[model samples]
Target chain A: MLKVEVDRTQCQNFGQCVVEAPNVFRLNSRDEMEYTPDVEDAELDNVEAAVDVCPMQAISLALGR
Target chain B: MSPPVVIVGASLGGLRSAEALRRCGYAGPITVFGDEPHAPYNRPPLSKDVLGGEVTHAAVAFPQRAATSDVEWRLGTRIRSADLEQRSIRTTDGEEVRYRALVVATGLRPKRLSPRTATLAGAFALRTLDDAAALRNALHPGVQVVIAGSGFVGCEVAATARQLGCEVTVVGSAELPMLGPLGSALAEDVMRRHVERGVRFRMGTHVAEALGQEAVEGVRLADGSEVACQVLVEAIGSLHNTEWLDGNDVNAAQGLRTDSAMRVLRADGSSWRDVFAVGDVARFPNAIYGDEPASIEHWNIPTETAKRASRILALQLAEDPRLDAAIAERFAPVPSFWSDQYDMSLLAYGLPALADRVELLAGKAGGDCVYGYFVGDRMVGVCGIGMRSEVLKHRDEVSRYGHVPIGEPAR
Candidate 1:
């Protein structure tokens, strides 16, 4: 499993991450971001892409035991 | 043994290049030089949160994703001169550093008004972290602030000043603020938003002179009208920081022109194989835009260009025979930039300057909307005001690499 974290304080809800990894991240109706805290390990690459494209660099990922 | 790869500027571009070099499996020593005494920090917030006093001084720091322990950091050291033939740069402290590969990311310096006006006590410009801190300190309630130029920096500063309860009066040479970049309709919308926020505008005019003999008491317009101000910020524009390349064949007056691969081009139009220019300092001919040479000053350009430069450097460091051929290859990443003012977050993809026609794609023009700029039948740029998802869809459609080019002619 992959554990994801987003620093909401730094996030401006640019939604670049959602476009890169839609399965892991999504924006609410208010245009704010909401993402899955944990996801399948196979989705690591997609999550990593999100990390790179996040405008605010607010996304962080950790691998689960 | 190969000489270490040396990166100048030590900001976003420099740091990202170092990290990308490591990711590319380059085992060589890496060194970064910065004129500023502090570590690399995020610059986009300098005019927003940093100037708004909404975030702490440390809040604006860019995440140091690049490991610093292995990299040699020469902070507060400015480069004075460069010798392209010798492949070395001399620092202001009289130190010469030779490198196997050089990455120039010196970026830009804010353009100030005349020395006479800029030297005034209350006159300022926000570029560096120190500049933002100083400007934030002056944003007391009811402080009359006069900002020259209606560019992103000036408008952002005005919005921030209003948030801090300061009275702001923006003076610009355009009839509507941000008309050059945001288009007249959206610019008028932004201007109206500012007016609704109680910020004043003196449009279609230029600042004739800085009022007050000691401090900036106000600004005298070309029409002989004076706007009272306790503080003055000249957010006019920026000049590329290329003075260190003074004697080099590259054009320092404009920007250091680079070939498709971001290699610095000499006056003879030959590529400097081991030397590359990244970030705002690099003026490269973009392949997507039909090889039009432009210097993009957006925040993301540095990161994207740095990655490309690192990939090329890595391939070269590995003694790959393809390095020579790769040097001539084109790197055309879809350019993007964003600006935040009050509640509006303007996002743009592709180059708006390349468009001849613009159409409203989704939503209303003044409200949350996406505007698409086209060159004939092809979408060249897409911009939005508070429209995130709609802009993303356009971004995907406009990008050459993103889900089939929207209007590519059959080859």
Candidate 2:
């Protein structure tokens, strides 16, 4: 499985993540993103997409069991 | 097995998120919904280039290479409801989209004048490309223009109006323009700049009403003073697009409240891991400023936050080992923003709201110079008028959380 994390301290709510991994990352009602912290291995491609799209460069990932 | 991705609000944040996803190698189909009929475009230049008649609307179109992932554009459609539990969204067109994840970048709208004033023909607000186009047409030579608020947008409009040869008067209740961010002293410099350029200032005054019948004929000040003008532009502030999420059980006010990871916070102040928010619509805490959450309205912050959100999402998908640590380290980017008014270019680094004190480091006031804002002894933010190269060099250091001598001059 893939693991996801966002640095809220650095985030300015730009919503670039929504465009990158719509399956895993989303902006909630207040125009903030609502996303899953973890996903199945099959969704790795979309998760990677999320990493590339975050404008603040606040997103990070690590391989896990 | 592909996961569905749905992004609402097809503007800068939406477009950049889509681009970032493609760059990160996501081949899944993507859907981007926008309330506007036009394709995603840059908005920064709307008040300047487009209004100045220096460039056409087409010139501001965000250049996109066809190879960048293809996004299913749902233009001219508004999202009526987002059923977070159902993992779906219902659009105004009655279409339901099921998504494994969602991104809300609905941004904010400009606050308008009261209905009593909006009925006047000359009243205007600039927030979108269309709004700028309409205002540009209304600005003609010899027109007397009265602008409300002395904020960045209002100041830019005032400068532009003067350049267009219009009789411009800016009315504000503050002693100087932009006292909120630039402070009264620097704001006075800005006000003086406009005065030197022939722009008039009605300082320490408030607009009681915008007067006119068919069009704006004049404005009534709180002091009972009447200033006649042919046009009025309201630049008071912006309202976040969060009313739709009313029953969504999320902790949302003017903007969505999010943690460092861009995840929406519950009403009880807990993170809602399943949902995330980005853009001007979300309010999150800053690490450098004692963890006080800030809602910034700038072009650069949104772009940077989206990139960080993407990386976090990718780690989750890859089952990253450092996921917990990564999330904890999120929200560390230094805040930065810039604005162009008349011949002056103002660049700001760090959050001015968090600064306890401000001092001029280099250059003279009312001229090309660099000013640094400090929180105690550490330089928390920097602002420069007409000094781009010097400011750009210090931006990285600020972003990396570097500190300059508090009261020392910038040599």
Which candidate wins on DockQ?
A: 1
RMSD to the true structure for each prediction, in A, is 4.0, 10.8
Native-to-model Cα distance after best TM-score fit, residue B49 in candidate 1, in Å: 2.0
Mark the regions of model 2 whose C-alpha exceeds 4 Å error after superposition.
A1-65, B1-3, B318-322, B396-411
- Tens digits of per-residue lDDT for model 1 on B1-411? 767899999888898888788877897899899999877878888888667765454676665653445888898999999888888999998999999889999998888878787678888988888788778888899999999999889999999999999999999999988776666667888999999999999999978888899888888999999998989999988888998888877755467888888889888888888899998888876667656457877777787788888888899889888887876676777777788899998888886656667789898977899888777778877889876877877776566632223222100
Interface RMSD of each: 1.9, 11.8
Give the per-residue lDDT digits (tens) of candidate 2, residues B278-332: 7788677656544545577777666666666655665665567876887989376
Pairs that collide in candidate 1 are none
Candidate 1 is graded, for docking, as: medium
Best by lDDT: 1
**Candidate that would win on TM-score:** 1
How does each model score on lDDT?
0.82, 0.72
- How accurately is candidate 1 docked according to DockQ? 0.51
